[model samples]
Every structure is written in structure tokens, then in C-alpha cells.
Target: MFTIEHDFDATVITLVDDPARHRQEDVTVNAFEDCVTLEQYDAQSDRVMRVTLSPAQVSDLAAALDLPEGVYKIGRKS
Candidate 1:
């Protein structure tokens, strides 16, 4: 399951794992103007872990989902 919310500075998207699936913590993605952040809880450390990505990296990641297994480079559209 997933949920989306629009905040003043960013758009927040939360991804919830299904009960039938493997037990995993939820992931929160925050999309900002300059960058995007992905966060998830770590049970071992008892803290939240966050990873920041640039716009280019986010674009590449989105493109990767539908692509075949191979190296790829994403270029900007005209």
C-alpha cells in the first residue's frame, strides 16, 4: 500500500509493506525542488536512515524500472 501527501516544501510518499509479504519497515520519500530523500526505519539501530538523491539520479532511477538488464544512461528530453 502507499499514500501520498503534499506538504508546503515537498511531496511525501509513504510505501507500506503488505502483511502477507516479508516484514519490513515502511519507506517515506520526500520530493523537494532541488532533491529527493528516501527514509526508512532501522530496527537494529533504532533510528531512521535517509538517503538523498539529486534530480538526475531520481530521473535515472525512474527510467531504470522499465528497462532491461544492462547499463544505461538517461538523457534529457528536448
Candidate 2:
């Protein structure tokens, strides 16, 4: 599973992969669009080690977060 870790000193995000609970790819909380800061990425691996979000993008992202009452479905293909 994914864990959002915060550096108490810096307050930066550090997403971690917990060994016991791996997540399914269909509904990943860590999913994000390709960076506009640069056209191409150098990392060849599947994991997204970092991200940069625009203000409007972040606002839309906040609303896309999970809801109560089982309203937020998981593992569905978008």
C-alpha cells in the first residue's frame, strides 16, 4: 500500500511503498499527469518518484479525492 509521509522538518511529501500491502494499478492515489515543466521524463521505471501540479489542477485533484458512503469507487478503469 501507499503511505504519504511528511518530513517534519521540511514538510515535503514522500510517498512510500509498504511491503505488506501493494496497491492495484487501476485506482492508484499516486497517479498524476506528465509534467509540463519538461516535455520528457528520464526515469525508465514505473514508479512516479515526484510530481508538480498547477494550482487549477490541484483544485480539481482535491475534489477527485475519495468520498464517504462508498461513493468513491476504486480499481475502476478511467
Candidate 3:
């Protein structure tokens, strides 16, 4: 399951793991104008872990998801 909210500064998306998947904790993604942040709770560390990605990195990641197993670079459209 997932939920999305629009904040003043950013859009927040929370991803909840399915019970059938047997996964604990949820992932939260915050998309800001300048960058994107992915966050999740860490039971072992007793804290939340966050990863930030630049706009370019986020675009690359989106493109990468549709690709097969191979190295590739995204080129600008003319």
C-alpha cells in the first residue's frame, strides 16, 4: 500500500509493505524541488536512514528501471 501527500515544500510518499511479503517497516520518499530523499526505519540502528538523490540521479534511476541487465547511459534528446 502507498500514500501520497503534498506539503508546502515537497511531496511525501509513504510505501507500506504488504503483509504477504513479510516485510517490516515502511519507506518514505520526499520529493523536493532540488532533490529527492528516500527514508526508512532501521530497527537494528534504532533510527531512520535516509538517502538523497540529485535530480539527474533520480532521472537516471527512473530510466534504469525499464532497462534490462546491462550498463547504459541516458543521452539527451536532440
Residue pairs whose backbone atoms clash in candidate 2: 1-21
Candidate 2's C-alpha runs over 4 A off are: 1-10, 21-50, 67-78
Q: Which of the numbered candidates is closest to the native, going by highest TM-score?
A: 1
Per-model TM values vs. the true structure: 0.92, 0.34, 0.91
Could you tell which candidate, 1 or 2, scores higher by lDDT?
1
Clashes of each: 0, 1, 0
Q: Put down candidate 2 lDDT per residue, 1-78, tens digits, no spaces.
A: 334434433223333334447532321233234321212223466554434565456555556774444444234233
Q: What do the candidate models score in CA lDDT, each in turn? A: 0.95, 0.39, 0.95
How would you encode candidate 1's per-residue C-alpha lDDT over 17-65 as one tens digit per residue?
Answer: 9896577999999999999999999999999999999999999999999
Name the better of 2 and 3 by lDDT. 3
lDDT of 3 by residue, 1-78 (tens): 999999999999999998876697999999999999999999999999999999889999999899999988888675
Model 1 weakest 10-residue run by lDDT:
16-25
- How much is 24 displaced in model 2, in angstroms? 11
Model 2: lowest-lDDT 10 consecutive positions = 33-42
